[model samples]
Target chain A: MFGLIGKMRAARGQRDAVIDVLRETTGALPGCLSYIVATDPADADAIWVTEVWTDQASHKASLQLPQVQAAIAKARPFIAGFEFQVETHPVGGVGLPASEKS
Target chain B: MFGLIGKMRAARGQRDAVIDVLRETTGALPGCLSYIVATDPADADAIWVTEVWTDQASHKASLQLPQVQAAIAKARPFIAGFEFQVETHPVGGVGLPASEKS
Candidate 1:
């Protein structure tokens, strides 16, 4: 499986708005096993996003989806920067579909 | 929910060994909804661990578990460094238990 872990910083005082856009736009994407958005404890303006997909191709394709594009557009103004964008190969784990377990 | 996202760098040529230790140790912990270990694609010696727990207390308590301690000890020799240890409050996501969904 493909995984992505990244941190995103929102513009000053716009963290909640960025999160709202993310929450509304994410869900039920094809080949997505998990997509979690979280609030950073140390940095109020930072958010972390963790995602698992069936494959790298699936993850790439999802970005081209209309909903995702719209969400990016909607959130662009509030997005300050992105950091620690690491891609990963998930071997196995809880919460993943049984088929994904090694 | 509580979430943790971190990067762990293993000693040279020990990434797989570290991953094995983590995979063996993580599972069925109390209040743990998800614990995923993935290999970093860009760095052979780096691994990314993403975790979700029912609450902050559960995550803290998990460190005291015998299995967790054992795993930490076993993995320590190969662990070179840790980075980007970010704590988060999970709002909602797919693959999380239905009850955890906001």
Candidate 2:
């Protein structure tokens, strides 16, 4: 599976608004196995995004989805910067189905 | 529930060795709900770790475990540097149980 971990810095005092866009945009991706957005405890203006997709192609394809594009448009103003981004090859874990392992 | 998304950069050629240690260290913690160690597709020297724990306290407690301590020591030499680390308060998602949501 394709995995991703990235950090985003929201505008000061706008973390919640950023997450609302994230929550709304996540599931619209067809191959997404899981998409989680979480608030950073240490950084008041940061959030971490974790994603598991069926494969690299699927993840690439997701960027073209209109919903994802819309979410990006909505969230852009709230984003201060990208802290870091990493693409990963997921092995497996709890919560993800066994099929996700391949 | 607590969620953590972090990225670590391994020594130039040591990402796999580091993950071997990570895989061994995870789940030894009592409150670990999920632990995934994935290799970065973009950077051969990077790895992303995604974790779900029962709570912050449990995650703190795990660091004191003998196994975890050993794993840290063993893996320390292979670490190049940390890219980013973010502590998150997780809501709920596909693999995670609904009970995890507070």
Best by lDDT: 1
* Candidate 2 per-residue C-alpha lDDT over B1-102 given as tens digits, one digit per residue, 9 for 90 to 100: 788777899998998899888876674468887777788667889888888888989999999998988999999999999987767887655455556643
Give model 1's TM-score versus the native structure: 0.93
Superposition error at A76 for model 2 (Å): 3.9
Best by TM-score: 1
TM-score per candidate = 0.93, 0.77
- Residue lDDT tens for model 1, A18-66: 9999888777889999888899878899988999999999989999999
- Tens-digit lDDT track of model 1 for B22-67: 8887768899988888988788898888999999999899999999
Clashing pairs in 1: none
Q: What lDDT, from 0 to 1, does candidate 2 have? A: 0.80
Provide the lDDT at B84 for model 2: 71
What TM-score does candidate 2 reach?
A: 0.77
The per-prediction tally of clashing pairs is 0, 1
